[model samples]
Structures are given as C-alpha cells and as structure tokens.
Target: MQTVVTAERLWDGTSLHQHPLILIEDGKIDSIATHDSAPIPARAQVHDFPGATLGPAFFDVHIHGAAGHDFMEATPQALDTIGTFLASHGTSAYLATTVTASLDATLRALDGLANEMAKLPQPGRARPLGIHLEGPFLSHEKRGVQPAEHLLAPSIATFDRLLEAAHGHVRLMTLAPELPGAVELAAHATSRGVRVSVGHSNATAAETRAAIAAGAVSATHTFNAMRPLDHREPGILGTVLTTDTLFSELICDGIHTEPEIVRLWWRAKGSERAILVTDAMAAAGMPDGEYQLGGFPVQVKDGRATARGVLAGSVLTLDRALANFVRFTGATIDQGLRLLSTNPAAMTGLAHRAGTLAPGKSANLVAIDAAGNLVGSIVGGIQAS
Candidate 1:
C-alpha cells in the first residue's frame, strides 16, 4: 500500500522544512519532497496534518518500563504495556533496560527480552530494538538505587553468560571502569559487538579515559550517580564532559539534573554527542504512588521517585523530555532530534534502518504540536492515535 502524508513542517532527522510531502510504501519511506515539487498520485492514500510538525520518531536507548509495568517482569504483557505507552509518546522503538539484580533474575529478564525481540512489534506499539544491561558491575560508592548485595566485579565469564542469556540481544552494557578487570571486560564486550558504557562509577579521570580507550563509547546518566567533577582530580564526570568521542546521556526531567547543568551539558556535548534519556521506571505515566522498579519497591511523591532516601527513577515521558530539552538548550526542534533520535539509533546500530525521515528508512515518525507535545505517531508506516 502507498501512503502520502503532508505536514505543516517536516524534520528529516537533521533539519526542518516547511510544507513537505512524504510518501511511504511497504513500510518504508519511498520519497520525501517539498510540497511544490512532490508528485502526488491520484490513487495514493493521503493524510494531511495541518497544524502538527512531522519528524523522525523518538528512540530511547535507556528505559526500564512504564504504565505500572517493569521490564524485569519478563512477560509479553509487560513489554506490550510499555510499548503501547512509548508509541503514544512518539517513540517508535526503545531498548528494554535492566537494573542490577541477582544473576538468575537478570538472566531471566534477558531471556524474556530476547524472546520479545524475536516477535514482531504489535501494530501501534514501539518496537523493542534490543536490551541495555545497566547493572551487575558497578561501584558500591555510587550504586545509587541499585542494591549493593548484587554488585559484582567485572568478569568476562559473567558478561558472556549474561550475553548468552540475552541471546545476543544485548546492545549496550553499563559498568564501572574503576573495577578490577574492567578494562579487559570492556574490550571483550566491544569485540563481540556490544557497546560498553561507563556509569554508576567512582573512577578518576585516568581510569575513565582508559575505559574509553578500551571501546567504552558512552557514559550513562552523566553526573547523576558517578563521581562528581573536582578541580584537582576531575573524576569520571570531568572525563565524560571533556572527552569529545564519548556520548553522554542526560535525564532531562529537571530532578536528575538541574536545568542550568543541562544547559551546560548541551553546550559542551553539542547536538551530536548529547543524548537524552528518561531513565524512567515503572512510575512513569502513573500518578503519585508506590511503584516497583526491577522487583524493588520505590516511592513517588511530588514527581520525585525515591527508594530508601535515594533517588530511584522518574515519571517523565519522551514528549516532555523533548520539550524540556528544547527549553533548556534553546535549541530548535530539528536539532533536538540528534539527542532523541539520531544519536541513539547510531549508537545501537539501528541507524541504517530507523531514526530518520528519509528515503529507504523505516517510515517511523511523529506528529507534534507547536510546543513540542506529541499528538500522534506512526510505527512502521501505521499511524497511531
């Protein structure tokens, strides 16, 4: 089937153009032309969005769950619930992120995530592109909400086991670079095609750089759980900020990072290296109350999610993240896609298929209001209300 969509504005991942025409066929974008130059067939199905801006769909590479369901539940229903919520928020795909837990429990979650990836994404749902392993090897000093008992030393054997359990669906992993054997483990994981990220660590600048040299390409939730930036020592946070090659994830919910700091981060990383992640747990989209994150209980009050006095996660949605990012950085909507769509897709090896609104790419896009609110979405060329 062929479909032609006309929008007031269109962002093709990098730049926004006025009055554009998009043609999708067989689940892929066939062509994108300006309104005046576009050839619209008489028999083609057409959908016009008058006041909405059409852009490449959002892609969250680091997310746990939403709508009262946690990905650790390891059930199709849990994924379905999360997927439905994400699609409605303009995300066409996401990584099913896991928290620190016992080996058995983590493996179980990995198995479930792999199984979910093997199946086709339901209509009007966000596709589960892969899994992000965010635990099992972290610094006790900066573990944040993750339980201390399950933290492990970096080991190739353990990583291999977890990788097997995920059935090669593990796209990214977060570990503390200061741990013993971390450099070797990072190299090993990178060799096998898994992107390694440094996070939840207390490593000094040198140690963090060593991990980056070992193929650690990113930092998770920069400046949140890791060592603080110091003038003399300049810990992991400093290394992350100054390193031009490393991508940094920022949770733009205002609670995890102050708006001023977010502005600074955006300035340093620019549009290319800065990535926005919610790090949101099951509390997202639900009212203020108690929620479960990775089998652990958490409290949500006044928009803050906490566990045992430590900040746990958030209740933020991608649409709001986009809005907050635009407001904080004074960036245009098209430039913001570098964080919300382009960087994540490129990091996870999905850039060839998804992430952009261009010919030969998946017809995954979003409809947003003038203020950057997601009003509708399209997944694999199928529109969602």
Candidate 2:
C-alpha cells in the first residue's frame, strides 16, 4: 500500500517546498513533489495537515532515556517505553547515552544495549542508532553528576574493552581533554570510527586545541561541565565557541543555560555548527520528582534535575528545545529545525541514516506550526499516537 503525506510547506533538511506532497511505499519515501507538480495517486492513503510545516523527524545524539526509564536499564521493556515517548515528541532516533558507573556495570549495560540496538525498529517508536559513552573518561573537577569513583583516565585498553562489549556499536564518546593521554585516546578512538567530543573538563585553550587537532570533532553541552571562558587564558569553552569546524551541543532548556547565553551560543556556532540535544533523562515526559540518572539519585523540581547540587541531564524534549532555541535566538524555523535534525546527524556521522528527507529513506517526519511547536510526528509512515 502507498501512503501520501501533504502539508502546507516542507523543509526536507536542505530545501523548502511549498504545497509539498510526499509518497511513501513500504515505509520508505518513494517520491516528493509539490501539489502543482504532481497529482496524488487515486489509491494511496492520504494524511494532510492544512497549516503545518513538515520536516525530517528529530535525531537526538545525546539522550539518556525518557518515560521514567533509564537507558542503563538496557532492557527491551525500557527501550520500548523510552522509544515510544521519544517518538511522540518528534524524535525518530537517538543514541543510547550511558553515564559513568562501575566498569562491570557499564560493560553489562553496553552488552545489553548493543543487543537491543540489533533489533528492528518498532512502528511508531524512536529507534536507538548506537551508543554514546559519556563517562569513565572525564575530569573529576568538572564531572557534574557523574559519579567520581567510576571516572577513569583515558585509556585505549579500557575503551577497547567497552567497545568490544558494545559489539563495536559505540559511535560517540565524551572525554576530558585535560586528562593525560586524552589526545592520544582521541586519535585512537577516531581511528576506530568513534567520534570524540570534549567536555567535563577544566582544560586550557591550548589543551582544547590539542584535542581538536587530535580528532575531537565536537564539544558536549557547551557551557556546562567545561572550563569557563576568560579574557586572558580563554579555555575549552572559548575554543569551542571560536572554532568554526567543531560542532557544539547545547541543551536549550532555560534551566541548563540562560537565554542570553543560548543566544550567544547561537551567534557563535550559527546554524551550521550548532546542534540541539535533550541530554534528557528518565524524568523527561514525567512529572517532577526524584529520578535516576545512571546509578545516581537526582531530584527533580520545576523542570530542573539535580544530583548533589549539580545539574544532572534534563527533562527537556527536542521539540521543546526547538521552541526555546527559536524564542531565544530569533532564528527562522528552518534554522531551528536543522539544529535539531541536520546538524546533530551530520556531527555524529549518521547523516546517511537520518537528517534528511529523500527518496529511499525511512518515512520519519514531524509536523510543526509556525512557532516551531510539534503538532504531530510520524515514524515509519505511522502517525505517533
């Protein structure tokens, strides 16, 4: 059976088409055209949104979990709950992010998550693309809520062990650039096809530059968990903002970053290098209360998630992040959409799997209003319920 989706306008990650009509067959996009360019097929099922802008569904490369379930659970039930919640909020795929924990526990979770990633994506659910290792190699001075005891020095041998446990499914890793051997680890991780992102550090400008030179492609959560920028010494935060080649992740929830700083980050990274991520935890989509981020207990109140007086992840969804970013930056909706979809996908090297609407691609997309609010989401040609 064929499905036809029509909207007032469409931004296919690269270009906008007015009166856009998309045809899907067997869950893949068959063709895209304007209403004036082609007639709708008589036998196809049609879904129309009169005043919505259709675009590629979001891809969250730095999410932990949602719907009161942590990705560290690494269970089928946990993934199903998280994925279903994510899809409803316009996310089509995400990286299963892991926080620092015991070496044995981390390996066990990785093994389980890799097995889950191997399964076919469920209809109307966001799928896990790969693993994002956000811990074990971090600066204790800037670890935030990441448990201190579990933090490890950068080590190729340890990374290799984790990668093997993940069955080579580790696509991204966050490391503190100031740690000894971190530059070498960055190079080695890049050699193994893993993208390195510098964060959780108090590194000086020169150390941050060394990491970038050694293949650190991005920065994690820009301002948070990073050395503050200074006029004389600068630091990792300064290098991240000034480096045009490096991608930077920002959690746009008003709690994680002030609006003024969000605006600053937007001006610095612009549309090309700026990426929006939820950095969401299990408390996302759930009522405020106590929640778990990895093995640590976090207190949630009024949209803030904290552990030991430090911000721990967030409860913001990508859709909300989109709206907040647009409100803060005054950027066009197309630019905001690209920050959540195109930039993150490109930064994580998963552009082929997501970030665009094209022929032979999965029929994953979302409908948003002029204000960048999510109106509806579709995954695998099925409308999210």
| Tens digits of lDDT, candidate 1, 47-97 | 888887888898898898999999999798998888888888888888899
Using TM-score as the measure, which candidate wins?
2
Number of the top-ranking candidate, with lDDT as the measure: 2
Worst 10 residues of 2 by lDDT: 376-385
Per-candidate Cα RMSD to the true structure, in Å, reads: 1.5, 0.9
lDDT of each: 0.88, 0.94
Q: Write the per-residue lDDT of candidate 2 for residues 1-385, one digit (tens) a residue.
A: 8989998999999998899999999888999999999899999999898888999999999999889999999999999999999999999999999999999999999999999999998878999988999999999999998999999999999999999999999999999999999999999999999999999999999999999999999999999999988999999999999999999999999998999999999999998999999999999999989989897899999989999888999999999999998888888888899998999899989999999999999999998888889988989988884
Per-prediction TM-score: 0.96, 0.98
Steric clashes per prediction? 0, 0
lDDT of 2 at 162: 97
